[model samples]
Target: MEMTGKCRLLGIVAALATATPVVAADAADVYGAPPIESGWKYQVALDGWFTALDGSIGLRGLPAADVNVSALDAIEHLEGAFAASFQATGDSWLLYSDFMWSKISADADVGPFGGTVGFEQEQVLFTALVGYEVPVNIQNMQLYATGGLRYQHYSVDLSIDPVFFPGINRSGSQSWVDPIVGMALHYDINDRWFVDVMADVGGFGIASDITLQGTATVGYNWTDTISSSFGYRALYTDHSDGGFRYDATQHGLFTRLSFHF
Candidate 1:
């Protein structure tokens, strides 16, 4: 009787040990690791750089004025931006909203006509976009293509001081909304270092008018929760009408720091 009781107890213990792993596996299959959900991401960026402007002006018949201005002397500028985004890891999608403010000013002298042409340009852009991460791998590098819609507001003020006409001044302003598309390439050196390059193009009016922008950035993932990046960007704008047509090339360095939760 004593032997029978000991055998019964051992058999029950072994059965329980076997069943425990099955139960754990069933639980994992039913409710896997917690799903990554909606969260807030924040970023702050600063940019400083110079631009070059080239174009021509035709005043109906007034000798078809040619504008050959070097933006290098007038391209010193500063900019800042902030953004809030929500990420869904399972779908590899992110919804982001951003606001940016920038100021660019330069002093220029226009010859033969009269006085000095001083230029001041300011712009504010607000955008809401949805992006999907396309998975591509090359060694330790990853690439993604992102496209979205945006609303942009741009303004420019041009002041001209004439040597002949002592107090004559002229200025102009413009604003518009447009759509944009972009792609990014990233290389991971480790869990804590990466670099990225991106570009975008957009059109603003019924005449198929448009603008293009591009950026290249290098970043340091300081910690699992924080990272910072620095890069250079270029922007180009074109218009159909002669009065509103001008080409601007901006080359500047920018820095951004982000916190993830």
Candidate 2:
């Protein structure tokens, strides 16, 4: 498969919490430390990921094409992108969910007729997980075992302009879901600083042959209910079906602003 061009939209989470300030309270602070209240805690977060794409894609029995697009290179063709996540935490159980959507356009020489090919693609990813805290002796730290489902949808449009034959246009979409299991670790450096790490693996040849993701971030509390973090994240997926194949890795800087209640 001689695939040519591919671009993944990097999300941007605006840290608007600083625009307005709130009094810091000690009773029930969020982010780094555990909640003091006995009731459930809720969190909403926005994220930005400026990633580089490296992978291969094939369609219609064609040879797989190489894809290498940088964040700067994708900016010109990026149409739209959005990403956000939600969380609910209890004494020893938690629920987390995330959603991301992106659209981009690219050009390549993969056309069967030896002409330029235009490719437009839109992708959506949603993930949800339930976790239970694992007991440990360490103080100011927590660990959780997590299980979840990941859903992916792709819509692609292709245009091929051949020298002799009429132009060809095609559009199609595919959707699939995968089962995943992982672990999360959160450690508080102090009253104002913290670190978080998470890793997951999925697929088991059920949907995509295999999928992997990892994230690590360091955050600072701005108030009892607001915080910001910056770190790195990497994700990889491999899947093939009905003459369509996508095996790619996206890795880059990750930023987030979170609100707790």
Candidate 3:
């Protein structure tokens, strides 16, 4: 499971229309609240992750087959990266979404003539999830199961500039969607402290070979309407289509600030 770049991006969503309070006024109230309502609760989260990517990619019509890349070293050529997410919660239900983007380019000397070979890659990932809470016996802990859809897009321009292979230029784009199923756990440690953990698995020949993700977060309530959190997330995906191939694991530390209404 992985989400990566030099710094990983996290997402947050606005509150949903529901019939419950977003946060407790104090420690005792954290465990219980009034019956559900029709109002909405939303959260916007901003995150940063020191993530590294490990994967293999290839393009058809190229002399070289698959090129291995490590986000650790490839990051040195990164031009930019960012992440963001949003969430909406209601009594017994929730909606969430996030986005991540990155741009990178690399250059290498090739051929006896000293010509150059290089490529520019841009990757984007977006995900949306919906879940329902199931009543459990554990006090102070909320448990839920979720279903989600994810779409990933990539564009690459590979070339051997000036000489290696005169008139050598190739560009391509691919996008796919995956359906995922998973669960989440939310526990109140006190009025101001809470913990959240989530895990998901998907892809059965419909999209990528297979994909999985997991997250753990510790959060502090700054106020009834605002909070901040720190966590870790990891993701893994395996895909091979036509002459394109990508198998990567991205993981690292993550931090976020959330706003609830």
- Model 3 residue 148 lDDT? 93
Ranking by lDDT: 2, 3, 1
Instruction: Give me the overall lDDT of model 1.
Output: 0.58
Candidate 3's TM-score reads 0.73
The segments of candidate 3 whose C-alpha lies over 4 angstroms from its true place after superposition are: 1-38, 62-76, 106-119, 157-171
User: How far is each candidate from the true structure, as Cα RMSD in Å?
Assistant: 6.8, 20.4, 17.0
Q: Which candidate tops TM-score?
A: 2
Q: Each candidate's lDDT (Cα)? A: 0.58, 0.83, 0.77
Candidate 1 lDDT over residue span 1-261, tens digit each: 999999999999999999998898788779875544564454433333344445542222222234444544444433332333232222555455556655656656677875676555566655555567777656776455666665554455555577877543444445556677776566887888888676777776643277777778888988876788877766665544444444444555655666655
After the best TM-score superposition of candidate 3, give how far the Cα of residue 57 lies from its true spot, in angstroms. 1.1
Candidate 3 residue lDDT tens string, 1-261 = 365542333322223223123343343376665644687689887766556665655667754333445556566888888888898878788798888888877777766778776777788988899989989998889888999998888887777676635657777777898899998888999999999888888887899889998889999998998888898988888876787666767777777888887
For model 2, residues 13-86, the per-residue Cα lDDT tens digits are 12334433342443235445654558898999998877767887666635566777777756677889899999
Q: Over 4 Å off in model 1, which ranges?
A: 1-90, 112-114, 139-142, 165-168, 204-208, 240-243
Clashing pairs in 1: none
Best to worst by TM-score, what's the order? Answer: 2, 3, 1
